[model samples]
Target: MYKFLLFLTASALPGVAAAQSADSDPAEAALAEIVERQDAARQPVELPDGRATQPVTLDAATITVTATGLGTTIQSTGQAVVVIDRKEIEQVQGADITRVLQRTPGLSLSRNGGAGSFTGVNLRGANAEQLLVLVDGVRVADPASPSGGFDFGNLLTGTVGKLDLLRGSNSTIWGSDAIGGVLDIATCGGSGVQGSFEYGARDTRFAQAAGGLETGALALGLTGSWFATDGFSAAANGTEPDGFEQFALGGSVFADVTDQLEVFAHANWSEGTLDIDGFAAPSFTLGDTAETQDTRRLWGDVGFAYYGNDLTLRAAYSMADTERDNFDPAAGSAPTFASDGHSERVQLRGEYRVLGGLSVAFGGEREWTAYSTSFNAREETGISGAYVQLGWVMGRLAAHIGSRIDDHDIFGTKTSFGADVSYGLGSDWRVRASVGEGFKAPTLFQLLSDFGNPRLRPEESTSFDIGIEQGQRGRGTHLALTAFRRDSADLIAFVSCFGATGGLCTDRPFGTYANTASARAQGIEAEAGIAVAEGFRLSAVYSLIDAEDRISGNELARRPRHSATLFADYEAAFGLRLGADLRLVSDSFDNAANSIRLDNYAVFDLRAAMPVSDVFEVFGRVENLFAENYQTAAGYASPGRGAFIGVRAAM
Candidate 1:
């Protein structure tokens, strides 16, 4: 692996040397090229110092592809969404994606321990399992998990270039597990070669490289990354140190078959090994133990697109496979626990213009999911869905109405409906509203496991939101406020049968899954950005969420009621950039009973970067500047003060 990485780095040295000998600064030139690409996609936002910057909030010119499953400007869609480009991503100066994502409104995250631990992301007060996550346009959820949710712990920001987060339910377009929202991640793309190397606290080492080539009718790209760290103890009271290591590779190919047709393919693979603490013998309490986990994931998709004067067609086949194994050194050399999950999907979609300013979108999809565990046999299920939508754009008004019908092999049939409208109040102001329905079928483990209940019902929800925006991006100031509410029914929950003799414990003496819970989540999201002065900018995001269980009337676990972030960036002399950010999270319960209370905490971070030469730049960051001790989970310990430095090169 090291040799291959060296080879990749050496292949790009010639280009770097050539750029270095140029008259212009290579760093500045690279920044200019990135800005030019962003401008071509959306309206360019500039700082008071005449430097280009990505906006913190969605503006009229911002385009979103996740909202409607098609490229549409924010002004034409009623759904609340946020977009983060590469420039903003690099500003964070970290591999952990959760660190940057938490700055967005209506989003929160909880990790079991430091990096490489199990991480969960919650949006708009909804559970992590209730949302959908897509990477490179492929669903990466693990079907073998209890809730079939995506884990963010292993997701590093190495190759990611863009992220679009749509904050509302829209199962009418995307089938299952979209009750909360959708997170769409796209990998880096462009005709360039870039790489970075870093060394940080805890003996951490990181390296990443990406290169892309664009010819007349063909475009290709490749990316690779490696990370290793001697992490701190996971248990709050443990003394032993844990560790983690990971390697990832990705590639993409796109070719123009004809003037109006194109084909593309993308693939990514990753493997990681992590040392974890688990329950010990005798006391059976959570603490330091000689246990470790190994995980491997592969995701890929092949698709084609055809463009005509007034019609567009697309088709794709995607697949994702995940395997996990847990080992205990005390037990034996063999893995104590093992599981694997696989998902395959085929989809075809098209859009046709019915008349002026009017168009219709329709699509159909078939999916198959299967899972196997050490103790349980392989189980599989299939689902098929079809949807149609009508969009109208007239003058300053835009509206979309859509519906979908899905048939599950075991759950029978389900239908969903959604509608949204947006109207421009003026050139710099707009108002929007939307209503949608969502549903998620039970996972294979929930229905086929030893403690599973075959009579479980699918979870369903109804959501509504309205919002208003004022001021245009790069125009000195921008602000947006949105309020949303969602009601869920038939939520799946586990029921323990420790002492029960009858009922759900007749045959299974451990536990059984059932749909005996309901919930309601309502909240307000506010965002603001201002050019404080020349060479400086300030942005703030706040969220007030009230998420509760209807049955117990208690706030959901790990869902903070009030969260806010304040960020500032300044461009100083000699092409130097400095940044600081503060994050505040209110206290919340750690369990359904609301007995374990997690304390509120605030964290601060500082970062800076300076150009060393035309082809290389140096950057450093201090995490947890105040060294404030805090914990997001009851038994897990969050990282304290840590410092890291890295160098980046582009050609």
Candidate 2:
């Protein structure tokens, strides 16, 4: 059945390719996500409330705050960063986070089933556990999880205003769990009100509302969203259906105590319930047994800032908590498994301009983490870290150097260093390169769970990347290419305890975590965007990766060797817009041993919007237009063709 769908989509490709003229090069439109703004000055624009708004020109070099916690444009920084703003997010209309993140060149995602299911994100071939995820500068990872990673499935794009995806390692700035990279998400905040409602296939429903207000030195923002779906069976061979329901709320407040000082606080809450199909234990076969999961998460932060003409100081306290419960009726159990994780953090940061064209930024942080499960004893750990970075910019050249030390109660200490340089080759061209080190501490569960090993060591990594970019704004053309490599060591993996080594105890028949894995990943990414015509634009991206486990001589699980995407949009009369996207992914193995193979596939989507007035608009989209059946995980089915329509209003 899937083969027929694949052939149908492949057959339609020739017509689209033939429509493009040789003179039309869609490089500028395609590379818009990565190209830096090209401004030559740092100016401050004041708002109506006498507050200064950071200056950001559309054509100016892309400025980044996640790389160094200091504002620096991509044209001047050596790190590879991709920025996704609210405008793009609105156009995509993604219900969840994974849909948006998978469009990036070097990022890949795997899901066990449909929306709200367990999802994993891999950046540049790195495991989900190796990356760090931050929401408004606060870490939201689950300390009780075996991998200590955040679940993308639970996050919605409706509340996000900006997303910064930084590729390559830079633990020197973000501390541990940055062996891959960083995903910094900034929630929506501003004076305005917007609301949306949608209905889609399979009894899917969505609704969202957001608003903000500012008066004098005080500002407040609030947002909420709800989603529900009658989803398909989670297992491939199952006939029963599963469903999901979720809700989220977020708010923030800020006040200026004095001219140079300000205070701020924010809180976020999300809860969800998911119905699932379970497999018969021991046989590993899908059955009619019913299972379900209930999840609740909360995050809060309070902070103060002192902004000076050439110096800035800030401090913040943050906390995050996550609780999950699983129930299985077939086992006649009230709750088969239940776990809770919490983390608390305090940080101080200072940045100063000590010399002309030279500035220094330094900070220190302390964190406490705890985990508890129904079947295991509660455990806790502490971590302390400090970092310093120096930045120098002169004419067309920019350079940055930084280092950090992280001390963990169980793993002792680990140090990392990183540096990057960017040079403007000419008015239309720029080149940049970066080299960095990264590390990850063992999660509390890995050290205290029943299958844990207390003596586990931290994983380490080294990575580097180089790239070149060229853009002709007047001609509406842009191009970018990047190559990167990463080597990791001492990766923690479960090992059988039956064969004891080095006089280690072997009381448990299962396995324990051990530092026994090493791997290397290399990839190339190319992006281009061009205006095909006055009313039409096209963008395309291609990525290639070679990731493997060195000791086992096996390819990394679920990391595709080839992937590409083509996007086209057209503006018509009467405030009408049309867009289409096609994505292609090659076959990949789903397990560590490279035994389970998933087939290659292509999926296409179509969307359209029409504005009835300045404040009202209607939009619709068709996903999996050809009903291409594919899977990112073995024994899991992808969504078939689905249609959705929605309306949005703003005041």
Candidate 3:
């Protein structure tokens, strides 16, 4: 893996080096010459709905693809969604994806400690494992994890170009884990040169570089970044400091094979090391132990897409690999734990226009997954699924319906379905409603681990939402309100083996995984944005959630009941930009039965930037401006009052 990443880096060095020269790069000129021969490959296709394929751009007013797994305008879709562009990310000057996501409505985040530590995310009152995360259309969940979830701590913001979040259940559109919502991330790519470097508190350093070339029917891009920090201690009671380091590399290529066929490929690799902290040791002594973890993640996809006047078809293959090792130097023993897992998927899908204002989509997918660990033997599983969906629109009215059937080797077969409708009231007002069913198959670890339960059933959920929105054209003003409810049954949880009998206790001998849990969550989300002046804007979002375990009647852990954010930004003709935001979270429980309490907290951030020339800019920001001391997780302290300054260059 290291060798592969090295080769990719070496291949792109000449272009990066040439970018630093005062004269135009000869390599770039050569690329142009090569592209000149492929000018007659791909052509734009017009859909029956009058939508035309164009160069991908970050225009929030236009459309998004994540909501429906197909192209649809934000205002036209019945689902609630938000788009965050690269410019908005830079305005916040944050390096962690979790920090950026916390500013959105109906989302909550908790971390074990500072940067690079274990982080948990809750969307619309759904658990972390219930939220699906996608990077460039590839699922990134770790099958080896107890809950088969993605870790947001390892996703840096330096290479992210766009983020699309759909807030509700749509398992029929995606797959498992969509019971919470979906976070779709797009990496940086364009026909230009761009990079940044920064120095901050705690001996921190950061650097990023990207290069791209596009001509005729072909385009290529590469981006890489490095980050390191002597982070604060992960445990509040420990004096030893923990640190983290990361390196990431990504590349993509697109080529038009013919007027109707286009081929594309993308790959990303990330490896990092993080310091770990332990709790109290024997005799009640604070465990300032020396522990560390090394983690590696790799993902790639390749496929061909064909576009016809009335039909579109796509076929693709993708895979994700994750490996991690944990060690304790203080104990002077071998690695304490390790896990390796991988997932591979193949899918074929097509969309055809059935009439003037109606379209239909059909697809089939097959997936294989496997996991290995130090203590457990390797295990594998497979699933196959097929689905169909219909979309229709007539002036102010739009509707969508979809259904899917998934067959698992052990769980037999299960079906899910969803439908949504929207009606536009005049030009500025609209109302929407949706209902959906979702299911999550047991994770490989959950079913095959030491505490395995081969007879466990899949978790199932039903969700519904209704909302109203108002938007003003050419006025930069929008307001939306939504109320949603979700009920889940047969959720998996570990149960003690004392008094257990028969096959349940035969697997683990200690505790057994069982379908002994049920839950309910309901929430209200409100968002508003307006142009305060010609160059200044203000936006805010507020969420109220009631999440509880139905059987125990206890509030879910680590989910705040009330959370809100307010943001303001301004830009001047003189190349100056200013931005600030405030985030507020109410107190919530840290453990089941609502016994442990985590305090409520508020954080403030400020940033400013100015361009000296068209190619260069300088910027700075202050996080936790008031130096507030807070903890999102018990015994874990959040960063306070840190300043970062950086310079960016683009050509």
Candidate 4:
């Protein structure tokens, strides 16, 4: 049967490709009793799960998902994906998405040193660049910039309303960068008045204010935030200091021209400075020290959506202008790098509830990325693609199948396919499984980089996942467990000690980027949330990864062995919320050679807030409570235990 589906989806030829459920469970006991009765009869009874036949609710679904490129709620989709809302973002006091991901299970990172400059994100076994980053559904990659890839430094936990982390292969829906997975950022439109202030140890501080005010057809919102830190010391004598500071501002607006047509836009800008450090701090001399290099990014996107009785037409235009300059006075001739990117995509997808429990939809996208670098020649990419997906439903059975064909101008053409199936075992419980093929084309920087190589080939992957989800009726408590495995081919890796002229790294000069042998990654993720009691709740997230090479006998660069995160909070009757958390990362290597080792460490944090009055509230947090020295970057140490305090005022 699975083979039939594969052949069918694959044959859809040059053809193609292709959440969260928002359902309530009632009297799980009744469902279990039925199961028991069937088991006693020594037969596979038809069972009784009324939910298997209910219609999906539109508003109560999960919008961002991995299995299908389309936006839909969790309960309605057939995949293993999760959404991290703003409330949960605070429940963890997480400064970066990486910190939040460690607790997410099945996902991990390879931190450069700190969130200072070059950082990357890895999903499954794919390289950091393979995991795509999107803001308001617009692509944010330079293709021409080195880390034009996804850099966690841009992580603004405070500026986002929610985060959608989709596991497995997403090439079918998102195009190239979707190989390993996709990280979708959804910004809040600021409705009504809102704000928050948090301060902690090591001179760390953060403040944000946002609100949405609507006066008829026009809805507008403004949000801005500031972040800074004194940092920690990795090696006692390391010359560079362990600290940093940043300032950011942004806003969004939306208007409804009619009951069926709406337009929206968002923008953000940030700048900061940080101390430099050497590999073996305290014992080694600082290399290429920079007091701070200032950077600013401006992202703007405008889109129009028309929702009809059965069809939707959506179009968006986006532009990203990222500029960076080194403030260090000594690094002579160090060219300032800048990236300008633009994308325009129009999607025509329509869905209809077929006669029975079956629904079908099809759509296509033409995406163009024009990237220019201040230090090198420009590179361009044009990808035209179309896909169709079908969702079949019946009592106790449902399946989703999808396929996509992308035509790339320079990287060669490619195709992707995927399918997912799920059946509710009974109240509060469901089992799911999925299989798919994914890919990542060469980035502009990888192909036309200063040390760029033109012979680079696209990276590819095969993946599978099995998961279980459970939630209590109406209480908002939920638990999920998912196990995943991925195999990557023609994996891309940075080789050191290349060509003659100087380069980013001596070995990387003439080395140029090339598809390495292969890699394998397997892991499990688990999460839980429960209202400990009314007004108080706790959430826990954890992930484990075992990633490695196919023949080199080396572990992939930057992928960690284990990670765990814990969050707890208490909400007071006065509308105040207090929270605490613990974060941990296991040991791992920084390079492919696996010589440089990063030690394992766990850090704790505490935060509290009080609704002082009707228009004011005060909050603060102490990070790294134990002062346990750790390095997000290989040689540099992160900030030690520190405290920050602040206030929020709104009308």
Candidate with top lDDT is 1
Q: Is candidate 2 or candidate 3 better by lDDT?
A: 3
Task: Give a tens-digit lDDT track for model 1, residues 1-651.
Answer: 763673467335322211211112221222233223323444344434565533333322255667877656666688898877666778888788988897789998888887899999999988899889998779999999989899999989877766779998888988889899999887766667887777898888777777778787887888787888899999988888888888888888878799768788989999999999988988888799989999999999999877665667778999999999999989999999999999999998877766655779889999999999999899999999999999986555679999999999988899999999987675467899999998888999999899888888889999999999876432468889999999999999999998989876999899899999999999999999899888899998999999999999999999999999999999886779899999999999999999999999999999998777887778899999999888888899888899999887778
Candidate 2 local lDDT, 51-152, one digit each (tens): 543322332125455678645555668888877665566677758676567657888778877788888888889998888998878899988888899888
How many residue pairs clash in all the candidates, one count each? 0, 20, 1, 48
Residue-pair clashes, model 4: 48
TM-score of each: 0.92, 0.90, 0.90, 0.83
Best by TM-score: 1
True-vs-predicted CA distance for residue 511, candidate 2, Å: 1.2
Ranking, TM-score, top scorer first:
1, 3, 2, 4
Candidate 1 residue 160 C-alpha distance from true site, Å: 0.8
- Give stretches of model 3 more than 4 Å off: 1-61, 283-287, 472-475
- List lDDT for all candidates, in order: 0.82, 0.78, 0.78, 0.63
Q: For every candidate structure, what is the RMSD over all alpha carbons to the true structure, in angstroms?
A: 5.7, 9.0, 6.0, 11.4
The positional error of residue 32 in candidate 2, measured at the CA in angstroms, is 20
* Candidate 3 per-residue lDDT over residues 260-318, each given as its tens digit: 77788889999999997875467554346688989999998999877665666778899
- Which has the better TM-score: candidate 1, or candidate 4? 1
TM-score of 3: 0.90
